[model samples]
Target: SAGSLQELLHVDIKVLMAGSTLRKVKSRSWKKQRHFRLLEDGLTIWYKSRWAGKGHSTFSVTELEMVREGHQSEVLLSIAEEFPAALCFTLVFHGRQGNLDLVAESPEEAQAWIQGVRKLIHRAQTMDEKERLDQWVWDWFQKADKNKDGKMNFKEVRKLLKMMNIEMNEEHAFHLFTMADKSGTGSLEIEQFVHFYKILTQRDEVWKVFQDYSGDGEKLMLEELDNFLRIEQQTGERSAQHAQELIERYEPSETGAMTLDGFQMYLCSQDGSIFKPEHQGLYQDMSQPLSHYFISSSHNTYLLEDQLRGHSSLEAYIKALKRGCRCVEVDSWDGNDGEPVVYHGHTLTSKILFRDIMSTLKEYAFKASDFPVILSLENHCGVEQQTVMAQHLRQILGDTLLTTLVDGQVPLQLPSPQVKIYAVGTDSFSLLLVYIPTFILYLCACRLNAHLLIASGHLIPTNSSKEKEKCGAENCPMASFALFSPLLQKSKSKLSRELSDLVVYCKSVHFHGFEHSRLHAKCYEMSSFSESKAKKLAKESGRDFVQYNTRQLSRIYPSGFRTDSSNYNPQDMWSVGCQIVALNFQTAGLEMDLNDGLFRQNNCCGYVLKPEFMTDGNAQFSPEKPDERQGYRPLRLSIQVISGQQLPKVNQKEGSIVDPLVRVEIYGVPQDQAKDETSHINNNGFNPVWNETLNFVITTPELALVRFVVEDYDKASRNDFIGQFTLPFKCIQAGYRHIHLLSRDGTAIPPSSLFVNISISELS
Candidate 1:
């Protein structure tokens, strides 16, 4: 009886039959506020209750009916005359009768009350009534099946739940759909489908709903629909209000209303809640520039000590760091009593106390400006000492530090206004969500990419929330706060659909020089569920579908990109994940080596393509999309060339035009042409070395292996790299010979030697 009542109302309210006839009703109290939710043809109202702990109670109602002014008098007379046993009818006239809100004292009473309301609201005056309901149900199924692949997959379903910040796991996801698939066809069919939500989301499986209703037979029946819809609407309303308040509190606009984009900005702002930037030093300015490229040099005990010594004095440290390094990496372990002291590795020698290091920096009069440190703490200590390290770091650094740690185990890092701690090293990424309730891998990815932190995939937790939040409404209680992923999608309350509006809010924060890491590849991955639909539609439309995944990143990203994989063994898959964002790409103080061939040959050249819409640094992509497929626009590029030698352009006429499938050539010249040799081969293949051209032949995709030949010769070895470039077709082209002799260090390439860029567009 309790279960049935809970399903119809979608509330966590318990009806205790304390003494048979004396049933006691207790509702879950709101941890936050009250809101409204939608169910098909009905709605649910939710408010915090003193009796209920963390769940909501929902009740379904039918649409109101209208009667002429004179008819109301007749309707009341007819009801009293025809069925006197029925509860007294109340007229909430906005001209007619609203749906009945019947109160019942027993389970049987409530059941009778609902039946009465259903009869009163469901007007079967014509055949069109049934047809409309059928059409509505069918339309819903079509809409939910985003890929049009005939089945609603987990990824798709999870995206819907993500808007509400709910995270579901696979086993639970299966259970959710099984309950929703009313016909038991092992799949959802419109015929058996109803707008019943409580039937869909009553399970408590961790990831069941998060997978987007994957793998199962879960179709909601008509009877169970109202409760789910009502709960969702109520939760959504409450969440929207809470999110708006957060935006208003942290980043209020000149106007009272906060834009969605502005709210996103608030989360990713370094100077805001999660990351706070304090000004220091004599030249401190509110408008002081921050470093974009965060360079970290790793070494053993000697280098570690040297780095510490280099930054021992304020003047010296400022000079070394002002040259523009963003992170200072260190290794640490727990002492006998669980005290966190910094050391390179396990050692018997004197180790540096974290306080001592900070005191030394302080003694040097190093201002906060000189030490905008992202201390990467490598925890070699066991799990038992994990919290101890965290406690010590928080104690030593207070509010001025932002640190990231990665041990193999998931750490218990919670969210606080002052300290932003994340568990970096994990195998599934989802484990982070499991271990730490408020920590999300999705946000972590965004944080790392936007220069909020340097994240290793093992310890990094961004993409998991995107994949974890799609539990079907049937498998879990709508009001379970335990089901929500606070890090991925946040909400002031569990039932709110918009949750905290974290995604949109973070987007706004990113624009105001606050780096929200989730906006990049993580967005692409989260957006992929939708983007795939676009790709499918384009295929149907006969347009090329240039869809890019994590695998194809090499085609676009530069070849020399390196990430923090220190915690993992070199061979672990987590150690070699693709970089979603290159945080260091935009730092201004130092000349970056953009041409490291991590992607293609002649590693000395790199290109940065701006999407066509960016103008004056304002992003042009429409932030919102009707479907996931609608929003991504075309890409434009701005090329940056960094070479140990000069770069040569493709000479139109004189250069050999090798067939696309036959040959390839990359040109390199001396940094200073006057000091290098120039060459051109004669018809006899003899010594007319003034302008010699180099050609590389390729008969198959594997022939591109010639790109690796640079490793053979000492001088030319390691000169060319093929990191992320994809050799799509069997091809070859050896055109112009423009080689430049460059000194060991990459600096001062002669401008006249050759360096040029051209624009091209490709769809993804």
Candidate 2:
């Protein structure tokens, strides 16, 4: 809790020290002036009506995702004419929480609140293990100070312990409390309570590991630290240099030796974080064809709940895109006034205007990712409404809409989404739309190298060969490509030619057999399969599926049977090299967890390069038969579940403490798939110790995803989920690492983590 983090804590929210009144804009019609103030802890914002005597409502700092100034949000933009843009801002939260739109009386006031909240968010996000512990202890101390007198006595401390998921023996707890009461005062202040917290959370597991490595009990010598790094952590030739760096960074005092505190700090530091640091940046080759990467996509993106009755919203698209969903689906149906509405076409679902969806898409397309965002228009509209949709897309998306073919011609290889290409406006975009009844057509000025080849109906290599020759003809007057898919053709009578041309990279097609795809599929052609169908293909013809995806794209969507908006196991699709495994982003579960974890890398730009075996065109790889093929050696992974730190309590039942257990699950090839569980630590969600070692033999290490879940054990009914974290096997760092848990909605639950020792070695 020292240095820059400490400074950041104090500087954050300082601007909000003096309270101010701001207009809380709910919608255009509902606006109320409220007095908003930051709490003394600088981690919560308390707001209330100016005259009401009602208890104040508060928002936690950790819940905040970001603050946007100058009418960036839809809510802020809604009342843009009413309020000056400089005075308007939005507070965006993590997960599915609704955004808070506010307008200050003055521009200075708005800027102050915006910057202060941002700093506070940065402080929370940057806190390290030790800093987090300190902050957590302080927050608990405040919570347990029932009298609000800024101090706590033994009785209050006891209550705090219960709230923290500890059912310790009374005598022992009092003993530790007395030890921290150094001032001889009957009550302990915030600092004293923090000291007591340190005593309670002393890591014996860390100490024993340190004792095994350190020559002396007090400090680990340099050579001994190096040995631990090489042997336990499996570090390579840079172990000595890495050990020196650790000593310099974490050692309490530069005495040329690492103390136990330093050793623990090193283990919890970024250098020792469970996720490999290299993968945290733009490390992957983004230049590869988009099909070569597993793209994060959303299914039924506008629906916030059950597809049949859920509300449709632009907020849903905003949230998904901000969370790095690269591809978003909009089921377009004709609405009143020639507008196209997006929703479940045949259901009683609510609708959002297609133009509004496009507006939101344009605003947030590159917010989290610069890579191209594919608008999978499930067009169910007639020609009039479809043309309107086309106009809105061209007007709203304008320059972002990549309308021309690569090299002014159909390419032998699909263009990468990150490819640098230019096809400026020739003002013929609108002309491309009104020409045909069911076809979308657009051709850039034929000035580049190769001739463009396209077909009006479901175009593929073998089937659309005649259209290819016609499209290659000089001054080919008409421009149209594939709009026909099983899903769209079944419903829609007409779709705009311009809207279909807007669909780049993801040229949807009805998937035939693998043999058919191998013979007729082109790089740009993509197939959408329901989860059931994809799963069957993966099980029956896994190798052929993998091979077909190497040059082409495949999207696996949820089955229509999932009426409740549930998700299928995306791993089934991903195992067969299916790139866009779209899930119901609104639904939070293991499926979403895996999706988040898989794409939670490479700056989370919504693409993870598929494994070499899956992407290499000539390589022979089978998802079902991983053992028989490959140069990669099998891995023996050993994970020691050490202790949990401040786990969350589910069920919200008063006076109920959690009986938490840690479960390590592996998802990948069927042979490598397994789950290992530790016995539950009863009545303790705070700092529970298991020290149980779970081991697994992973045949396909490249494909395996490791998920660590902590659950509240219930003997009477099903166990409740507390928190989880998932990441690829290759991103894992060996030796002692902390798995910081995330809430069910994939938001960070700070200080809630499992301290574990991970060791990965090649299996004999």
Candidate 3:
């Protein structure tokens, strides 16, 4: 009867198993007793309606299981299969161990030996046939050979082995390579690699053997290799374990990994000498591409806060605030009778109660450290409204907020200094008209000891019509310089100067700005000639040149820069090409960190333009035609590594030897700035300085060679490390064809840093 009731565990057992009626149990005793009758069996039981609402019911069982274990039979728990309904099931047993004993023996074999759990319930699904070992290896080799090179490089091979959780060093690399290159020509060709692939994929047993041999933990060492050869000489061929042991013996002392050079020595008693010119000075040159950051001003504070909502959780937002983001904007407007309320609009509907937002922030606020959150309140109304809002912010954030006007006027006589307020101005508005003059307001805020003040304004263009008309082309520079001359002559006050610095600090400054093609889509125009002969003529005649014009300057210069076209004029072509070369060096060779600079040049050729800072309705410029007002084009330099050499293996137990500094120097500058010149700096062409005093010892032949990257020159230490740097190659109308190192032209140091040694076997 109990087994039948257990079978109906999911449904009401009284109805499903017992076939008894609930109406028959209707008595005063049934209400107080908390009991029910099973339908079919007419069995009485205690019950509670735990899951009252959702379409589910709860049940519990109190049972006993007694088994003679030595006699050997499986006793299954039927109640445990019902999940949460059997959550409170109590199974009383005569000889079974308790819950604590089961936990303790789980770590030992007692539970495994006594549980009688013969079958495994969970198993993994079968993988697709395409994912077999043979297919994976073929795909890996193809992708690894980027230029269809027959062999895979260290970087490419290392990445694949790393994914398998088997760090394949140089020693193990050749072992696997030789295994795959079955016919042993020191290389594996694509067409001839069919059998290895077939063996790898055809059987799981074969694949497993390869995996074991490839794994570093099981690979052969040098001692094992020698033993294998000695034994094989007496018998026949070498075993896989012997080969693995031979490979393991060549592991480097420092990292216990093998490099290509070390692997070759161990495998074939040969050192390979293949070098690409581009990879020569890789460790010495440190030029890197510039990093970009975007800054935008929200028209009002509520919109700014609303936009940032989904980016991070409230907890994360508070965490970020604690980390460092001090300058924050809050919009406020005048309430009834000019009581300040934290709202961005003049209308009352847009107003948000200050207390509500503060309460929400407090709920999730990180309060480990105390750092003031600078609140910039913009008034929709006039200065009067701004004054009222400042008072309200001071009340809400206390001394954390400050109030000041541009003319060095402070409001509210608080005991401690309040927060600094900045007055923002636009190109269309003068400083005095925008709430408070920005510069003067910043000074006033500084006098009150405010932490930050942001003076928002537009950078007036150098080529503005008003500016051009005042001085024309010849005197444009003088006119532009004259306008700012007066500001430089003032008797600088401590507060005013400090405030000016604040403005400069907060301003989004662009360094080495250039136009890029991605953002400035219509900046350059490309036209192709129908006939190749005509196209050649046009290109030769300097008539088919494409031009890039900035109808509007980018928010950041060179946000969208372009390259030269195939049909461009020689002068234009060379200039664009030089720029590409220069930018390449800037990104790849030098090691200076720039806030903003020329990142990289595209494959397409065209000159870059400073996006017009401000656009004019009347200003017209042709995209196909050039004007001298576009300014002087400067030549850029890109560095290339020509050649390099590695030192001979040495025994490190002896004295150390210093490595020679490999240097490349570029020298040449045009004597006259105005000369239409084509001379490299100092008439020697573009030179890069590369000196390598940094050295590591090779103490033992066992594992001494290590690879290190030479990034860029450290101005302070006079050494090099991999870092961001920029070498500004200054040449106008100057063409540098190539980079050279140690040359009457470009020579190598032949054998300067090479060192090798051999010691007696007794030293080992």
Candidate 4:
């Protein structure tokens, strides 16, 4: 039966079950025996019920998590509390906030189901560096082979690099093409293409980095290797052992020294490299309340340029998702083609079809990360278009879209293994219960809860019973709804019964002041503030903001006045533990660069667990109030600016030389600080050694970032930026380090680096 179903669905699926009775968690009705197929993209279950005829439901692999057979009590309790009726051998599948449990014939069948699902998941999770590189190269090759000739010419190769936002000189492009074309046929075959891609993505700087420590430019003895690993690699006491092991593993002879190839192998290994392993853990604690972590987000994610006149395209979504942005905004309006469109409202920006945007999202949603994507939908469409928009989203997103509460009941407390009830706030009604039909909830306000709601308009209060009756009976329809209670500051205000039923977990609250937020409900209270307002609030009450954000979700968006779609420095908000720091995805500036760098950690999964201090409700951490902590140690940083190699010339004109200078800047909460060495005048940009040591004392090293800036000095004008590299101070390794430079757009410039010696000490 599963084989037949696989052929029908046109997917390569391994059969997990030939027949089984499945019960809908929401309805508690058992359907007739059906076949289950595990597809590459998702799981498909085909069944027939008395009320509903033959049908098949497909759940995306990204949305499904397996719960082992014996470890199903907590899941069962979470589901039973929501849906009263259930049977044994039920395999529970968890989404963002919803759970679906399918009943199997026996525990053996359930274990088989779990094992099958996990096998596919394991394959997806174990994508190593080489596998990822291969996938990346293949995706680009497919895009570049517009003619579908299985080969790319020099022109196509150049276009591919440009489309990827990589800048390359024409001469360099020609040279690369010539080298990749092994047969001198002026085209790169698939193998040749992969060879070229490896060259572009490979880290050849390992040779140069090794030479910095070896001093002889050829090999490194055991002591030299140990010192390099201890100081530059930050390997601590095990540096000597690791060095000996590396030499034993990679050295060709008993010379007790490592060559260039040996060093490269060590750098590319799992235990020795900066790159995270492919199966790196996705999260620290999945059971923690969603409000406790910072989620990477993008503002005006559909536009490619200024908010006033930028081009709106599906490419924006792809780019943002690939960069580990979990939350993306979509501004929707009714289009002339009877379909909803997405664009910046009240601006000269162009529009793209909503269906096209959905398609792009489906393809690229989990490419970079497998976290839940929050679609911040700003709806400005008529009722008809609104229904159409909902239809498109449901059809395209399929089961990946979260549409219901996790346990079927409004959570009375924070999520814990025991389902323990935690006090929300001092408010009388900590948890409100109401009943409304799903369709009615959709019709009343498309703004789903934080997970998946359609926002028709700004939520307002209904004062009188007559007003409430009118709001519900006419504007909104209500039946039976189980939703999270809304926490409103105003004591006397009333809301429509239908509207109140839709506010499940994320309650929209207008930010009044810091004092109001401290006393508010923890996980249930949600607030959105403009970037400027948030920044001002953080500046005035940084500690309060940090404490408030510890247990609540705060969304900081771009200021309304930014017509050019410029972004604010997200680090300022991150310093206070603001969860959602939304930025303009199109703007490439220091703010975006910093955003990219911050999210680059934690496996680039877009959701990073807040620091222990930030998540502890009572612990206080403020950049301005460092002395408040009694045992805090100041971080002293020492950087020796050695030299630059193969630095790009600012002016491309012949006979022009760059007067290179190195500027080391430290950015943190107390204030921005910078120290620059004198520019080496008249020394061409090639390999100028300054030998100048710059030192800085940092109070908040955790929130600080060190920036290495290379500039071309000019006598009469502002110096031009040749390259820059910025990273969080905690991620910085000690000792002799080579800092690879990045272009203004943040793409790595191959083989370009600054050699430096860095040491960090804790001040007494």
Candidate 5:
């Protein structure tokens, strides 16, 4: 009755840390007492109602982002007047999941749960593959131990195998069960079950590969290990020093040489990761001008879901900022309360107090990236509320907000995000109007101080310029940014002039032809492009687009037709050197994967410097005709699909077994796009092997992304996506590697991976 947490009485945690009945608070009017307990493994939490239930309700510590105490969340704050903040705590989860608000009977109890959960989360995060596997097995053991006797009989083992999507002959199952039940009690304990699991999940694939490399059929000498790395992994490096270090690190038992155990561990290490470990740190140059890098950005940063009927909350801003997004959109409108509100205007999307959003921005702006954030203001508020917006921004952001130009002088190019803590461009001031009559209203927003202000506006959903709305057409947001023009500045009012004078580096402008831009467009004048328009330009005038982005900042956003808040492939825009390719941060898909993959490096600072060819305004570069460009060298990439380890099962039916398949896709220039896949292995979600080789020719490696996809194959219907991992093509290391797969939402499904051999050579 006390639960299996009797075993959780570890030295670090107190005995009372087992479980407690805490009040789960959904709202101020609704609170229910639920019994909460941490499982014995310390990775999962289980909660139940007062009455006994047939099934269990649980949440993993891995799902949690962090735990905050004392009315830290809005839900907890709602009951602050009724309940003391000291007795309340909130569990913040990753992604779009809602927060868990709870109240303890006393402050001491609350601290116990909070500190206990924090410790568990820390342990879960630090666990290695083997440790994770052990916990996973323990979890299964808990599920199968129906009598709560800490042991499993033949019937339960058979049932457990079915639950794990494994169908085995009864005789063979019993034979293995008997082998594990060393005491001959006709039942197996936790240790016995672990041994049985090891027998069932024997790595035959690993043994074959090991036998291929190990000359003595046991261990490898230093030269033999070097040969394995050079010949089998295609590293082509014969070094005793590197081999010795690896042998020392992976080979246990003080063995001087590498053994099968060491080989297996090394194959699953950071050195064996598909993404080069050397690229994990702050490896890229960050000193370039802001425009010279591809910046991680989010469109409609207030909306949590689709544009229509979505709740606009500060959590969206927090999520984006925490994920290293440098550019965040704020659609400011005049609220009925005489304050500015941020939301999708004219739609059923909920509204949030603009000041609250500002406060969240100030708190989380530098948590993920120390780079300067671009606050893109889509102003719809009147002058009075605009002034309030300005006040709140200044008040909340304080010294972090960029008010004046760096060194108080005009900048030739936008400043680097790393060079300053925040603030850079001057064009953060003017062009805040919705209608021409409200031009002075935007001037009222002059009091606002931000690091970088990339301003745009829309009277309705889209700008009413007939030529601009091409079903999925692009609009040059010049009407809203009209005040920044030199001609408009001459006769504008003083308030207007105050804002206009502040329009420094990033003055928004309409993109005409390339010839026109070459002759007239200043380096500071940037352009915004819709997805379709940007794609068209990148296809028709790709060279010009690349050349244009070299000197000016270009932003590409999704088309208005994407009401579901779906994202376009950011790789396309990045290929054309678009600095700001904004996506719906609330949505998850292949597009966001590419965004995450590209920004996963360079300290994850939300900025990746463009390649040298794309950095010069005069450089001859074309994403379409990459083969013809200077220094163009096409490379051949070959990936050998080997085996999958501990992949997750999709179907929940007892008899269901997944037929797994691996697909490799390349996203890049028109000529370099390719896809290759392996045939499915029937009835095997665990340790399926297919030694198929997939090949591709990448003409523009710098702009390409390689994606590895695993799916549960079904001939009768659409296959279920198991997991995938995506990264820039150039980040791949040519060697034997393990690609750790990720779930649909991009979180790590630990211990799930694909073993492979990679080779890169000049295309012949």
Candidate 6:
């Protein structure tokens, strides 16, 4: 049967199924033979039954998670109680929550199956951008070929670009199509299509960078190379020796001079990889607790415009998820339809169907990063709609929804089919728990009760008592000493037995003050503070906030003043080790750019582990108190601003010779330090040379970002931003480096980079 199946399938499919065995397992009432096949993009499992005929299912490799031993084994054992002797090795599908247990005939056979599946998974996990791009091109070709033809025409190419959200001029598209159509038939084959894409995406700046140093317009002489290296060097007089070493390393022919191809290879080798191989350990530490990491989060993730009148679309979720946002917010309100809707309540924002949002979540959940997505549900629906909401979530999310503890703890029983939903009622005192699960659901008060709280302020003696009594009473306003005694008596009636079962790890409480967070009862507490309040707290009591956040999760969101849905600098919160620094995902600015840069490390998995000193849970460490630790060393950063290549023009005129200047900024705690050239070079956008050096004394190099901004100088008007580059100091290499400029929207401006030399040293 396997041999016959092999003949029916493609060569690549047969190779993946070559060593694996097919076994018969009972599905419902009928028995079926299961055959596993790996595709370029995903895995296919075919099932053939005697009476029920044949069926198959395909799963994206990104969605597949191999569940072995421990909790997985326990779940299998529970399932086996029904079937008695079913061969079981559980495979959990993320987001979809589909679980499949393959039955092996023997222990050795099961081991082989596990090994084979894991090997495929490992290959999928390590699939780099280039491989994914190739697969995408193939997939796009199939989709664009509407008639199932082997070739695509110019119309199909335009449709393909539209599908990919790429905006290209009609002339450029036709030109590219003509170039790819080698047969001159006005159509492109798959090979030609891929070639066209590769050429289109290829950076032409490599040749330009090479030609910048090439004196003869062809090859770089030894003396010219040496002088270039000397200018690139930070504090060295041995540029001649370094130049000799570089020539020996990159020189391909017998000639002493370096060719354009050889120089391009040297540049490619340096800037090719975003994450260096040596930085692998930074992302590999998954053993730590979830609270020990800073999670990339988005606030009001459904909104795409102004906070009060924005359109709420599923596109927002897709964009945020693709950008490595692990935590997303959903504001659910009961819709006119039977199902619930997600939107900002009390606003003119349009709503989207809850089911549609769930479907979007399932599709794009693991596309950017293969990590668990946290759905921060802000429920505003009534009990009936809440029940319907839970039903839809169960039907949609299925098993991918995390119900139990993922921290390797063995639960008393397997997670129930239903989710544990929690909601704060309109009355504010009433807490509703709709499902049966031991997991905790955080519920924050929607409305502010400043007037009521201020009137009853004296009744609440201290912030600690306020927290304790508020938890017991479930009141929006902190129960006062007068109200606390009676509330404690009536707490039994208000609190349900299900509350104990639901409240486990995370409990949402309004942040009172820094001192309130230091209390013992606030250990497992989670707090959401406005950005202004958080900044004030950080300034007034930064050390306390840092110590508090070291153990528990603290969320910082934009203040109410940001009606435009603009984002604040998340790096400020991150500097203090705040876990959830929520930003407006729709708006693109310096804030979101820094957010992208920080999470770009660690596979952009949305969760970056906090530094060791921050995670130690000791109050002794502080960014302000740098002298307390030996690891805190003063860094001397020296940057040489050399020249800009094909620098972007502010004005749209054809032959506008714009005046440009470079402004260098170092952002970190203690305050932001900046410096800029006093004068701007006029009449040169092609290549403006500064040949100036700047120095900065960094007290905390670990939490610093070096940002280089290019602006067009104007005497009559304000200077306009041409483009800028921002990156962490840790990733910056010491030598001749290229600073690639990015637009305000975080898109790369090709062939635009500031050539700079960097040298970092410790101050004795």
Models 1 onward score TM values of: 0.24, 0.89, 0.21, 0.62, 0.88, 0.60
| Candidate 4's TM-score | 0.62
Report every candidate's CA lDDT: 0.26, 0.80, 0.25, 0.64, 0.77, 0.63
**Residues 1-764, model 5: lDDT tens digits:** 12333444553356234678889998789998988887666677888887767555898888998989897776787799988988999998876677899999988888888887787777777766456667788888989999999989999999888777666789998999999999999999888888999898877878887788788898988888888777766555545677888888778757699887778878887777898767877888776887789999999999988998898878788889888898898887778989888887768998888898878888788888777788766665655776687777667777666655554444567666654433334587544422110000111121122222323221212234553453233423322334333332332312212223333456656577788888877665667788999999988999998888887788888887788999998888888899989999999888988898888877788888888899976689888788778789989998989889878889987788889999999998888788989999988777788999998899999888999999999899999999999998878888778999988888887778999988899977
Q: Which portions of model 3 miss their true places by more than 4 Å?
A: 1-327, 335-339, 343-376, 381-388, 392-764
Better of 3 and 6 by lDDT: 6
Candidate 1 wrongly placed segments (more than 4 Å): 1-330, 336-376, 382-388, 391-399, 402-764
Write candidate 6's Cα lDDT for 1-764 as tens digits: 12222333544344445434444332344434565555433334433333455555555544565545322332344456543343456665432133565666555556555665665556545644334345456666776887877889898887766554344568997987888888999888888988777655544545566667788877888887776665543315876776677667766776888776556445433332222334433445755655678788999999878888997877678778877888888877778977889887777998888887877787778787666566666656655776676666656776665533433333322222123455577787698765422212343323222111111111222346546664564432222212222332332212222222232334455566666656642344567777987887777777777777766777787876788998898877877878889999788777877787777677777878777777777545566665675577778888877777557667765345567788887777764345555357786555667878888888777677777788889999998888877766676766656676877666555456676667778987
Model 3, range 1-764, lDDT digits (tens) per residue? Answer: 33333443543332323222111111122311121222222122223333334433222111112111121110112222322221121222211111101111121222221221111100001212222222334544664565676665445544434332222346766556567675666656664444433332232322232233333533334444344334421212543444444345444343334333223233222111111122222222111100011111111223212222211112222322322222223344445665545542322224454443343234322242222232333323334554444343344444232232222422111111112344456664654322211111111111111212222221222335676676455432222221111231231212211112222111121212123422422211111111232223324432112122112111111111111111111112221111111111111122111111111111001112112211122233222122321432322222222212222112222122212223322221111111111111110011112311221211111111111122222335544321111111211011111111111111121121111111112211
- Using TM-score as the yardstick, the better of models 1 and 3 is 1
Q: In candidate 4, which residue ranges exceed 4 Å CA deviation?
A: 1-219, 231-234, 248-256, 259-287, 412-504, 671-678
Candidate 4 lDDT over 466-538, as tens digits, reads 6557545332212122132352222222233332444344555556577776764545556777788888888
| Model 1 lDDT per residue over 656-698, tens place | 2211010122211111011111221112110011212232221
Q: What lDDT, from 0 to 1, does candidate 6 have?
A: 0.63
| Best by the lDDT measure | 2
Q: After superposition, how far is residue 303 of candidate 4 from its true place, in Å?
A: 0.7
Query: What is the lDDT for 379 in model 4?
Result: 59
Superior by TM-score: candidate 3 or candidate 6: 6
Worst 10 residues of 2 by lDDT: 435-444
* Model 2 lDDT per residue over 1-764, tens place: 32443465443356576788999998799999999998767677999998889967898888998998898876777788989999998998999878898999998889889898998888888776677666667778778999899889999988888888778889999999999999989889877877888788888888999999877688999999999989988788999999998899888777999998888777767776799888988898877887788989899899988998898888899899988898788877779877788888667888888888888877787878888777766655666886787798788877667666545765567667565654344675432321100111221111011122111244221225565475575322122344444443443334445555465555655567888878876676667777888898999999999999899877777877788999998988899999888899999999999999998889998889999999898888997788767696899999999999888878565477899999999999988889989999999998899999999999898889999999999999999999999999989988788888999999988778899988888876
Best model per TM-score: 2
* Of 1 and 6, the candidate ranking higher by lDDT: 6
